[model samples]
Each structure stands twice: as structure tokens, then as C-alpha cells.
Target: MSQSAAVSPSIDLPENKSGPHTSRLGLITVVATFGGLLFGYDTGVINGALEPMKLDLGLNPAKEGFVVSILIFGAALGALIGGNLADRYGRKHNIMLLALVFMVGTLGCCLAPNWQMLGLFRFILGLAVGGASTTVPIYLAEVSPFEKRGSLVTRNEVMIVSGQFAAFIINAILFSVWGEHEVIWRYMLAVAVLPAIALFVGMMSMPESPRWLASKGRKQEAFEVLSQIRSPERAAAEMEEINALSTNGDSRPTSSWKDLTTPWIRRLIIIGIGVGVFQQLTGINSIMYYGTQLLQQAGFTSQGAIVANTLFGLASVVGICIGLMVMNKLDRRVMLLGGFVLTTLFHLLVGLSAYFLPESAAKPYVVLSLVIAFVFFMQGTIGPLAWLLLSEIFPLHVRSYAMGVCVFMLWITNATVAFVFPPIVSQFGIAPTFFLFAALGVLALIFIGTMVPETRGKTLEEFEDEFKAEYS
Candidate 1:
């Protein structure tokens, strides 16, 4: 890609008129983001539920890690295949199937008779999570008008953090009410089933992605879907561009895996993978999945730790809201670069505090404050930006496959961190563990500064043309 491409100015498109069409688009976004909500709740409920689950399930540290990380391993597989499934079956159809999987997995986990059964169900749940992660953003991106794309696409990020926040609150409440009960974790896990059912029912009325329809030579069907969401004039105009791009030899959609061997496609894949991998390297999930334990290690009681961890979830929710408000006004690359710098600085501060601060009552508070700051910056910037970029950067022909491969690497990295964090933190201390993350953050910063391109203002077709012109 050209250096100038990294600094392209925003495009000015005609404003979308507000009407029933606008309301319909908003409704669709709400329905689709339930996938994100489930993703957040299922992953985060583990933070508080794990302690009681360990007691009830006779879990060792290794078993605890396996139970938590197995879902991520399943997610990796889901992401790997999800893209192709969406490409083959259609985005809306793929999502509906995933919702059923979510219900099954959640119920299975709720009724699991043993630790092994819980792990099996968790992995099953992960497949739904992974599929949703890859499919929902693409669905959002394709359906949204370019001007509102940033905020709309990032709404999934908002729902994701909100779900995490809900999990934390529910976990705290259930733990307080049933702290004596061995069955409390079952209730926490079962909450996910409600959203899964909502997503399935809600999507039944939702339209398929117009772009996916155009790709499959269903242009009339695509236009009807677009008309329901956009003004007739705007929908017609957008369809012309979609059709033109579809017919153009230079931008033809390629389904074969061999097309990935093309240079420009390979380059985008690399950048996409880098974005996904570095997002995980931020150690955000480690904090999300183990915040209670980390707080306990800092000297709080188990109850206090669980309560304190809710603050982390709250910070993520607030941060993503801030991210949504500013998303359209800022450059994607700048937000990512700044997020990395701030998160890395906080990682260093966290390590320093854990190492230099005395073992006093104030130490945990100080560390907690620093971690909150880190999550704030992370969720506000990198968290949403990573998914937004992945959704935008690929050419239409290869978007699903490329995103799948990228998100697959992402979940793999997440699973590695989730599985190893306990053992690493147990063997080493929090300070050393954070220091290692700080080191990884430096490398991630370098990658973002050098490789990430600007996708701030261009429509999907325009960006694809620019990339093809620059790199073909």
C-alpha cells in the first residue's frame, strides 16, 4: 500500500434521510448485536463462577484453566469455518444457526454433571460465540451506510462490553444471595440462554446482508433489502455501485482458497491477522476472565475481589460508549496507535505498582485503579477499532474468509493466554506477568504504527479500489 493511502482524507457522501427505513436499520442492529451480548456474558461469567465451580467440580488449577480456555479453542474452530459458512449459506442464516447452537451450549453447561461435561458444553458454546464474532460485524458493515458505518459497526463492541457488565452484576448478585450454595454457578451460566433465544427469534424477521445478496447474483433481492433500510434513491445508487464492482474484472469475488496466494489479498490478510492477534496480546481478556483472582492476589477477600471486579466491567462499558461517540470523527489508525501506547503504559505501571508498592491496604487499590485505566483506554480504542478495521479492510470477494482466518488467529491467541495465565501467574508473580505483557505491547505498537492503513472515510468499494490500485 502507498504511504499516502495511510493518510487519505474522509469522503463526503450525501446524508441519509431519517424515516421508517432508519428505524428499521436500528432495529436490525439491535437484533444482531445480541450475538455480541452472548459472547460477552459467556466469556465473562467465568470470572466469578470459576471459584464456586472449582469447589463443586473438584477442579485443580490446570483443570480450571482447561475449563475456561476450552471455549476459546472451540471459538477458534468456529471462526475458522464461520466465514465460509456465511459465504455459502448467507449471513443471516449462519447467525440463526449459531443462535440455536448458543442455546444448546448454554443449557448443556447449566446441566453438566461433571467438570468434563462442563468443558464439553463450554466448547460447544464457543462455536456459537466464534461464529457470531465473525458474522455479526460483517453483517453490520455490509448493511450500514458508509457515513454511519463506524458507529453502527462498533455498536457490537458496545453490546459486548455491556454483556460483560451484566454478567459481572448478575454474578455479584447471585454470589451474594447464594454464596452458600454449590449450584450458584449454574444460574449464572444459564442466563446466556435468554439472549440466545432472543437472537434466534429476532433474526427470523431480519433481512440478509444486501452485499452478500448482490454477490450471489440476487441483485433484486438485495435491492429490496437495501430499500427497507435506505432511501430509495440511495439504495438504487448503492446498488449500481455494487453491481459495477461485481461485474468489474479487477474486483471479481473469488471463493477459492488459492486466491489468497495473490499478493494484495495476502497483504490484507496479514494486516487483518496482525490486528486480531495484537488485540488479544493486550491482555484484556486475562483481566476480564481473571480479574477477581487478580484482585484477591492483591489482598482483597474473595467477596471483595468479585465486587471489585465489577468495576473493571463498568470501566469497559463506559470506555466503549466513549468509543462509539468519537468513532466517526477520528482516524482508525490513530485510535489504534494511541490505544496501544496508553495500554502499554498502563501495563508498565501495573507491573511497577505490583513490584514497588509496599504490601499495604492501599496497594490493591492502586493496582485496581491502574487496571481500570488500562481497560478504559483499551475498550475505548483498540477493542472496537480492531473489529471495525477487520470488517472494512477486506475486499468483498474475500472478506468472510479473510476475517475468519484473522479471527481464528485471534481466538487462538486468546485461548493460549487464557490457558496459560493461571500457571504463569502462579509460577511467576503478577508483576512479572504484566511485565511480559508490557513487552508484547511494545511489539504490537510497532506493528500498528508501521502497517495499519487508514480506512476512516472511504466506502467499502472505494477502499477496495484504492488498495487494488496501490498493491496489485
Candidate 2:
């Protein structure tokens, strides 16, 4: 993406005071983000479960990495097609299907007869995860008023982190109670099934995205859905805006994969892909998925590390909560650059502490603090903001499709990092691994500084116009 650098001008939208329907909007957000909860639990469970699983399945280092990273490969595929599925079916329907996949996949993994079966089941679970990563944010963004869009859509990220925290807590409790029980990992994996059921039942009552309805020319249906979420006047106003942006005009272009090849649209999609790739390469998910392993390498015992890993998850939850509260007040570019800088420093500190602390009793706790700081800065800034921008940056016609492509790249990058991480640490040690991440973080900071556009408070329509100017 060329950084031609258009100066951003914010558009002031009409004030939309909260109404009686605000509670209804909150309900929908909570229900939709159950996808995120399942996304979090399924992915985070392996961090704590990997050891017991290894003992039970006789997994070597290479096989263990495959088992852990295969789900991400499946997620990459899921994200690749998830957009077309959401548009072809409705977003709510696709999400409900994902919920069923979550239940079946969790049960399959919990009851797997061998490592092979377990890997298969985990990939199945990843399908749901990848789909949710794309669909929930778009659904939330479309239903939300522009003023509340960032917080509302980011609520999914919050749920994702909260789900991971819940996994850490459950894993710790199970490990403490069961001690060396071989099947303890099964319980951790199976707990995700409960939220899958919740997501399925909850989405049954949720409405489809009104913006999607308008895109399909079902204007009245879209209006009805909007009225349920927005005040009467604001609902009508939003309906007008959606209609104006819809495909009613003879000059309006069709949304398709082919449109992605257009010069202007291609640049926007490139930017979206950059956003996704940078978010993953920052190495945040490494901690989310492998915190216990990292801590043990730092000097803690396995059990102690599993218990202490909960702190990482807890800090993530807190950071996401803070991000949600202050998200509306910040510029996306500024916050992202600041986050990358902090994460780079934290990574360097973690590497240096491990290299120099030298077999001391205090080394583990000291390293843990640095990791915790990294998690806080990450989840608080780039983690939530990345998903927020991906959901908001694309035009209404191509929103879901573009987001699918972006997240597909995100999962692929995530999988690459996860797959290579164990081998890298094994060959280079924890200090050198972290030093590599720190260097990558520096490059990611440069990418954000030069390439990403500021999307704070901009309407989807306003962004649409900006993209159109490239073609005009």
C-alpha cells in the first residue's frame, strides 16, 4: 500500500442520545459476542492443557506443535470463506451454525481416541473460531450507531479476552484439584461447549444486520430491525443513510470478488491485510496460547507456571475493559503506534531479563512482570483496536467480504508464528526468541506509522467516499 497520505477530516454526526432501546442493543451485543467467548476458550484451553495432553497422547515436540497450530490453519480456511457464507446466508444464521460446530468440535476433542482424532477435532473447533472472528465484529458494527460503534464492536474482543481468562481460571482450578490426572485436559476443552450452546440459543432471537438487509434491497425489513435498536427518529435517519448508500442507483457498483481487483479497492484491501498481519506478528497470541510454557522456561515449575499464567489472562481482561472504556476517545493510528513501541520495549526487557538473571530464584517473577506489562499494553490498545478498524474500514457493500480476507491473513500469520514458536525456542532459547519478536515489533511500528489510516469516529459512508476518491 502506497502511503499517499490523505489528511483525515472528521465528520460530525448528529447526536444520538441513549434511548429505552439501549438495553436492547446491549442485549444483542452480549449475545453476539458469545461467538467471541467460544473463540477465546477453545484457543486458550490448549495453553494449559498441552502438558497433560502430551502425557496422555505421547506427543513429541514436533507433533505437539502441529496439534496446537493446526486449528489456526483451519481457522485460516474458515476465514477465507466465512465472508461469502455470511453474505450468502445471513450473519445470524452463519453464527448459529458456527455455534453448533463449536459444540461438536469441543465434544470430539474431549473424547478423542488418539492424538490424530484430537487434532481433527481441534481443527473443527477452529472453523467456528475463524468464522466468529470475521462475522461477530461485522454484525456488531452494522447494527451499532456510528458513535457507539467502536465500543460495541470491540465488546467482542473483550469477550474474547474474558473467555481466555475464564479458561486460565478453569485450567488452574482443574490442575489444582486433579493434580496429575491424565484426563484433566479433557474437562478444560469440554467447558467451551457450554458457551456454544448459549451462543446458539441466544442468536435464535437476534436480528440480522440491517445494513445487510438494505444492501439486498429489503429496505422495509432493514428499517424494522433498525427501529428495534435505535430511537424512532434516529432509526429513520439511519435508514435514509443506508438507502442512500445502497445499490438503488444505476451508477452503483456491485460488490463481488472481482471488485477487489480494482485499483482503489485493492489498496484499501491491502491496508486491511497489513492491519491484520501486523496485529498477529506483534506476538500477542504467543502469550495467550503459550504463557505457561514461556513462564516455565523463565524458571518456574510447571504447576507454578500454570497457576501464575492466570495473571496474564487476568491482565488481558483488565486491559480490554480499559480499552473499551476509553476507545472512543483515541485516534487509531496514535494508539497503535504507542502500543507497538511499548510492546517492543517489553519484549526486549523480557529477553534481557532471561539472558542476564542467571538461574536465580527471583528470575521467574521478574520475567512474569515484564510479560504482564506486555499483555496489558497489547490488549489495551492494538488488540481491540485492530479488530475495530478491520470491521469499520471497509465499505458497507463489501464489509463482510473484506473483513473475511483480512482475518484470513490474520489467522495465517497467527498460525505461522505458533507453528514456528516451539521450534524457535527450542533452537534459540527463550531470550533469543523474544529478541526476534522485539525486532519484528519495531518493523510493525513502522508499518503502522506510515500505512494505517485513522478511522476514529468516521461513518462507514464517510470511509466509502474516501475510498471512492482514489478511483475518481
- Cα shift from native, residue 227, model 2 (Å): 0.5
Writing each residue's lDDT as its tens digit, candidate 2 over 1-472 gives 2232222323333556688779889999999999999899888989889889999899998789889998998898888677768877778889999999999999999999898999998899888899999999999998988777889999999999999999999999998999589989999898998899999999999999988877777789999998899888878777776666664341232457886787777877988898889889878898988889888878899889999999999999999999889887777787788888998999899999988887888888999999999999999999999999899878776777878888999999999888777678778888998899999898888788876877666677766766577553
* Candidate 1, run of 10 with poorest lDDT: 3-12
TM-score of 1: 0.97
User: What shift in Å separates residue 196 of candidate 2 from its native position after superposition?
Assistant: 0.6
TM-score of each prediction: 0.97, 0.95
Which residue ranges in model 2 land beyond 4 Å of their true spot? 1-13, 247-255
What lDDT tens digits, residue by residue, belong to model 1 across residues 193-237? 999999999999999999988888888999999999998777887
| Local accuracy by lDDT, each model | 0.90, 0.85
lDDT of 1: 0.90
